[model samples]
Target: MQGKKFGTFAGVFTPSILTILGVIMYMRLGWVVGNAGLIGAIMIIVLAHVIAISTGLSVSSVATDKKIGAGGVYYILSRSMGIPIGGSIGIALYIGTALSIALYLIGFAESFNGYFGFGLTINDIRLTGTIALLTLTCLALISTSVAIKAQFFILAAIIISIVAIFFGNSNFQPETIQLFSSVDAVPLEVVFAIFFPAVTGFTAGIAMSGDLKDPKESIPKGTLLAIGTGLIIYIGVAVFLAFNVSSEVLRTDYNILMKIALFAPAVLAGIWGATLSSALGGILGGPRILQAMSIDNVTPKIFRKGRGKNNEPVNALFLVFVIAEAGILVGELDVIARVVSMFYLTAYGFINISYFLESWANPDFQPSFKIKSWIGLLGFMACFAVMFKLDMLAMLGAFAIIAGLYIWLQRKEVRLQSNDVWQSVWENVVNKGLKKIDANIDENLNWNPNIILFSGESKHQSYLLELGKTVSGRTGIVTNFKLILDKKNNKPLKKVDQIVRDDTFAELGIFARQVKVDNIYNGITNIATTYGFSGVEPNTIMMGWPKGLENSTEYSKMTETLLHLDYNLLYLDFDRKKKFGKYQTVDFWWRETDSKNAEMMLNIARFIIASPNWNKTKIRVLFVNNNNVNQEIISSKIRELVEDLRVLVDIEIINNAVEQKPFYTIIEEYSEKTDLTVVGIPNYKIEKQAEFVLKTNHLFETIGSTLLVKAANNFNVLDLDFIEIK
Candidate 1:
């Protein structure tokens, strides 16, 4: 049962034709012709169809190129514009379609009230409309085929009525066609508003895109054919009304078709059938849109379920029925018609804009059916022009609703399968920028750190990424790399591991990779040197503190080699569990004047303080008492240095004796109150292995989380001349 699907005629043309030749044709076309005259009415039809046909061309071009699934216009727009804009417009279209059901039902009720209610109340008319809405909704729930088959009978009644009116006329008076209404000439824009909706039901077919067997082939053919057919019918009706009816009668009676028909009964039947068929079309199309949005997770997930053996969207159909019945209570057909028109026109405008942007900016948007970009632009402009003239406040309200929905959906972060068109747009922009940068690649005053961070294992490394992002400012590249020593396996990165690592890095919006090699040192050296673009190569290497002194020699060797290659090194020993207290302090230890690490540490702390998490972090400069050094002189020098640098920090003089206790204990005691500490690595010396081992162990045991730095002296020291006594 699920295998059966709708082809072009039953799925697309039938609904499109039924909706286009609906209540407006039988009930309102004569009124439009009466007010606007023959030429003005024709102009209105042509302008409305121009927007419809142009939008159809764009829809066709995109439909032919991709496998368009459910969501119809929503699918097309979302796939082209991304989920946020697409979802918002889809919601508006859904509401429009829902209201369309109500509009058709009220039209049916009004005609029913007029024909059968000589002595009945308006409430009775509402009951009949309610009954009709329920019957059609049940048919829609049972099968789309049921409602579609009902349209055949409706179509037959309409044809007989049209034949009676056109051929049954004895005389065609061409001179009776007035340029303006005999009573009062309605504005051309107002007439266009009333007439424009006639051309819009063509998209009702597109709403059933999910049920069609081949939407790509059916949507374009059936939609365009419907538009062309509606245009011809409207033109013929406008001409017939102009010549056959007196301008005074046309202006006075909106139901002039019934009064002039050879068989008044058949004409009455045509009005009822046209209204019912259009209601059927809405019932059939609106639910499918809700179902598609549900499937895409834009709507609630429960709506994704269907009850029928053929997977008909019965739940969504019920939802549409409830909304239509509510609309039946209001029961004002003309006002409902105008409100529905605003939503439809806005949707049409967005559809054209999506296609225009695709054609102009996205090189990947290759469609088999090509449409000129200007047609889309023109269609988009025309839709808004007519919309504002119809009702400015209503149009603004509709736009506000769509924009609000877009903001809400963006915050929800709904994910879809379509590729982001923004990526292609950005790619083109960046390509042009790169070409411009090639000519002046070596200009001075451009400094960005392309970093290669050594991630030993993938556990608890989120802070590493945070620091990388903090320093890079999202302008430079930071790659988290893991090196495996076993080289035998061809694909050393396990799928599960890659997925876990990717998910971790994706949260921080960073890049991560793993490389397997015979030696870890060789892997690090190779990747760091050859990782990034020329003139933007990896200028920095960052690593966490080593586990013990056992790997110090190898690490020192790596540092020397990296420094020789003009790369700066940063070593961090921070714990992820630490939280910032009310009084946040960053302790910086100055070892000597030659330690360029002083400048690098201060710069990094400044970056940290700029972040929201560490916004109030205070910096404190600390130094141990040296041989015969005066504490007052040192404290005064630190003050002078802080004043010169124009930064706020505390100057601490530590009096702990290094000979009495381990250097780690003294440093830890002095820095116990601080949140994070900054220390510099002493210059590498091959003759002092024991001393290096002792210092490495003691420093790693400092009170708080610490950062170890070894600057390559690639930058000048901060000016300290003011700190020197005059």
Candidate 2:
């Protein structure tokens, strides 16, 4: 196996075929037939085979398209999807594969004990299983090549057993062979689930990909042939059992085939051989998955440690031993079967989806052995529905664990330097979206605050991204940019992409962008003007409050440049001392003279309320009327603003009766206690730049967390209220 490259037969055909005609076939098939009758059992077998074939076809297509490495399915997935998704699937596949050891060892012990033990206890059976596990683990650890050679004997045993089943005679007369056995039977889906693990062994050969001489050719050829051969054997055996064996015996005896065989000893040997071989397949396959993941930097580095000239994964093999023993501890064959089925079904579903998405999204996904993409889609849908039908909670738990692993991988800094179909998938989606938006550019549409912020460093400025997210809520988009000043970027493009990825706060959906720009203003201008196309363009720009007039001139000029670009501006003067304190009260400063600014300010507050963190927050429409001028009119105007805003908010007017002080003084005295305050920036104040900076800075100098908004339009909110209804 080390120096010589095995071809289709020894490499793929033997392992796959032997494993397919394995534990499930020997131990569980009779029980399945008894519960589901002849026709229903055939349907289950056929359905399971269909999924297996679809998945095999998918693996074949992808294998043909790329030069897969040691990880087999893990390698294919990591290359097709990102490492996170692939790693998650790989972990689950490894567990399922390792647990197959338990499933088979239990089956083996059951058959071995029943034949040899003159009425052995269940504990005795478990002990037999443990001994088998220990022996197999030692064999696998010593030499995988020797393990491959040993399968020859196992295959012969399986062949003899299969012959015995067909040629044997049983004295026990079976009841009428009903197409549909309607007597107290379990659900078809449950039987299907139990039987599905049988056909899932088709991937056994695939896991031996690294040792194959021509994986592209052998994989598809060997795998498809194995599936076809297994289907034939399963159908033949099911039909023969329906005719030759008693329904009562089939229902009661787990090893009914042994009783009705041409030679009971041959059938028993076949059961033992099949179970051992399948367990060995898992022992060989599961560790390699861990080795692959370890190599990919997802798992612990020690699992990648190999021994001998062939580079066997010694550490990973031992890890599989532990996991397998854990699975065996459950002791119930049916329970083990159900759990293994869920894991494999999830893997099969993802395999189908990976193929479907890759073929459709990418033109380079042309394989020599190309099949219909819809087959993969159909397989995915079928697996998904079947898993839920079998056991919704189990399926959900499996998926949840996968998701948990995915998230954990996502948070890790192990960036895989490989291309995935996701980029193409997103490109296809964006292309269609841009076309639609282009077609409807002239039509009036609802506004979404797609904001871009010049956040300095992601590690330090999470609060900025947080505020920006609140500004947009779930309906809007936020791109947090960190500009690295470098006229001539001496770093490689790959390193730059990595840097950007490192800077990104991807969990919040706001992937941070770190760009090397010669000039800050020019970079920002280019990004702002051309960052996005059609409706996704940044309509709003946000900046953190400048500290003590440092770079105030640059900040002011940048603000003016962007403001003139017709972009709505928000300057968050975040109070780190009181970070969104209490989320109790938010004050919206309302003024008729600067009504447009007021609308934007009010909307920002409303969007903040929409955030789960601030959903319970109450809004106050604060009207600053310090002079004793039109007190009643001011109250009515504030109420009208609330009505026009259409958001439920309390109105607070600070007239002469309430606070006999200047407007600026009154803001500090009354509004300083509010949680989040939205203040309007008027046009005239902005015209006088220095005064505007001084006054605005002075305004929020004593306030808590705050938003300073300047709307792009001179539109009246009072009038837009009527237009909103019409």
Candidate 3:
């Protein structure tokens, strides 16, 4: 494994071509021609090769584009597509390759018994296969290069056998050829599945990419040549069988080619050679895949161990032997063939997907042998369709197994030291979506709050970010900017962004950002005026409640600036001493003049209850009606609004005109035991912050944790879920 020994022909083409013209050609081609006539069989041949050639193109494109890591397809995919998906597919490819050994041996044993057995049965074939697996496993454990040397002789036998079969005499059968066969044979899809494994050997070379002198040049050249060579031989044999042999005989005899060849011994030698060579190829390839997976921590560490100076994967080879033995015990070539086909198809599909996404996502991916991304997509689609056609239940079960493995790998956090395409893909999607969206949205019909946080209190940053998430209700976004009051105005914006860009703040759709300013008041004003885009701009400014009357004047001025910009102001009066006790009750105080605030407050209340802590908490809408309105009438009006908003609330209407207790007094009596209370800031003159703060401070003293909301627009209360009041 450590030596630079193989050139293009020995490394890639010889092994690949040997496997492609293998067990299926000797044992199953006549059956396929019988089940589907000449035209139908040719269609199957062409269709299967389309996937192969497409996958080949994708493989070439990826291989030539970059310097893929060692470990063949596994390394290429893990580097290009990320590890979890790569490991999932890599494991499948290894199993497929290992199980294929059993399939070839089963064919060999059947052919051997037909030529020399004294009326032996399936049991005899199984015995022969076990012997063959042991012999091949020993050869592999001894020296892998011996297997490569053997393939040259195997290739010669296969060519001679093809020549013998072509010249062999068959019973006159000009009338046997038909466009389609009778329903007596198995379904067309079944025939296709049985024949599908023949084309899969095209990738046999890709698994040995690490051994190539220049994989970039050798891989594409050798792989494409093998596929082309296999295609010509396959279609030639299919047409010959259709025209020379009678359909009834073709249907009945699995080894009709070997029986009717010009020199039966030569054909038998070819059959033996093809089957053994393919098994040998699998033996040589499967362990390498497992070994790669082990070294990458995708599998256990023990399988990564090797023997001798060449570092042969002796442990992984034993595992392959075990799986191949189990496959042999299954004792049905068609069953084994179908399993092999499904596995190969699954891996091939993902390979194309990886290539397709990588080409589009990575702008630097310019391959000398570039193929259209549509070709890769086409390959993916064809594989998917063929898998379902082969066996619907089997296809679903295979996908489920692969998906389960992928999930397990993800949980293990299989980190590869490479970049994946997801970030670029997501950015492209977002950029396209943003460019396509209109700036002006119908506010009443479809809107969600985009909150901008400019809080002065650093200790409550996490709380404010979480609150933004809760209020957005998954339909909006949040941006938290920790305003660093740099009176010197010395910090650059690059470092400013770095200031608040902690990984923790970006959770739950919040964008963590920072800015430097001379004062909190001017910073909020300038940032709010400039932040965000036109369509999804920030319409709400969230800030912690002012701590003392010392800065009430500046806070009041900032509040006026936001109001003038037509933005809603939500001041969180979070009580650290009694932080949102039990989240049991939400009281939204309402009045006629505070109708707009009532809408925003109701939206916030709905968002609060959606949180896990408050999901079961009920909303209690408490209205203080001052116009001497009838209690029941006010209750019905508010009830209609809540019902239209599709939310549940207990309506409590108090006719303050009858017993006009102060607003703070009413809160002290009813909301003293509540977990959270919502109130609105009354409209006042810009210079009257001292008067406003004095009353608001007392209200907070009377209530528990509270949100003081002031809306700048008269938005409909019923459309709180959709509308944004900016």
Q: What lDDT score belongs to each candidate, Candidate 1 first?
A: 0.76, 0.80, 0.81
Residue pairs clashing in model 1 are none
Q: Ranking by lDDT, best first?
A: 3, 2, 1
Give the C-alpha lDDT of model 3: 0.81
Decreasing TM-score order of the candidates: 3, 2, 1
Model 2 residue 598 lDDT score: 68
Q: What is the lDDT for 1 in model 2?
A: 37
| Model 2 CA lDDT for position 194 | 70
Once model 2 is optimally superposed onto the true structure by TM-score, how far is the C-alpha of residue 368 displaced, in angstroms? 2.7
lDDT of 1 at 451: 76
lDDT (10s digit) by residue, model 3, range 382-440: 99999988787767767877888899999999886667766666767776677766444
Candidate 2 per-residue lDDT, tens place, 26-73, comes to: 778988888899998998898888889899999899999988778888
Worst 10 residues of 1 by lDDT: 717-726
Candidate that beats the other on lDDT, 2 or 3, i.e. the better one: 3
Q: Over the full model, what C-alpha lDDT does candidate 1 score relative to the true structure?
A: 0.76
Runs in model 3 deviating more than 4 A are: 118-127, 134-146, 172-176, 300-315, 329-340, 438-445, 454-465, 481-536, 564-566, 629-644, 658-664, 712-726
Better of 1 and 3 by TM-score: 3
